[model samples]
Target: MKKSILFASALLASSMLFADSLKLEGTIAQIYDNNKTLLIDSIYGGQMAIKVLPNTEIEMDDCGIFGTDKDGTFKDLKVGNFLE
Candidate 1:
């Protein structure tokens, strides 16, 4: 019974984590001039951008696509956006 309870708790925890994971889907709202990035507005009013590989679909958890630089200059990102 203890083993079963632990397994169930683990499953529930994983499910909650998965639920918080971001899943975005929409058209390319904007694309940077560098030809390496694009913005996407999700159907639920959230927006973010992922690094592009010429003509590939956007994905989450891809580091180095957005954020600020050492000198505080924003990197590959614009206003009115979030990091999903």
Candidate 2:
């Protein structure tokens, strides 16, 4: 099946310790619900597996396309969705 890709504006996360967080933009190549992880084909030129913790925050912020931001759950994550 063909996969869909989504993009969003840059994300800036701040921590109390002022540490810089690693940011990546990528396409969701695969989803592993059993492990709560995603296999991402990164635009940076490689594939990475990211584990989504229970505390992970998921949001759909496509104001330009969807008109508003929506809180998202793990079930909302599908193969091919762009993540950053």
Each model's lDDT comes to 0.60, 0.82
Count backbone clashes in candidate 2: 0
Top candidate on lDDT is 2
- Mind sharing the TM-score for model 1? 0.35
lDDT of 2 by residue, 1-83 (tens): 12322222112223433454577799899999999999999999999999999999999866686588888988999998989
Ten-residue region with minimum lDDT total, candidate 2: 4-13
- Predicted candidate 1, C-alpha RMSD: 12.5
Taking the tens digit of each residue's C-alpha lDDT, what string does model 1 give over 1-84?
Answer: 999999999999999989857576565677676756668886677766667564443233334657433322224445444434
> Between which residue pairs do clashes occur in model 2?
none
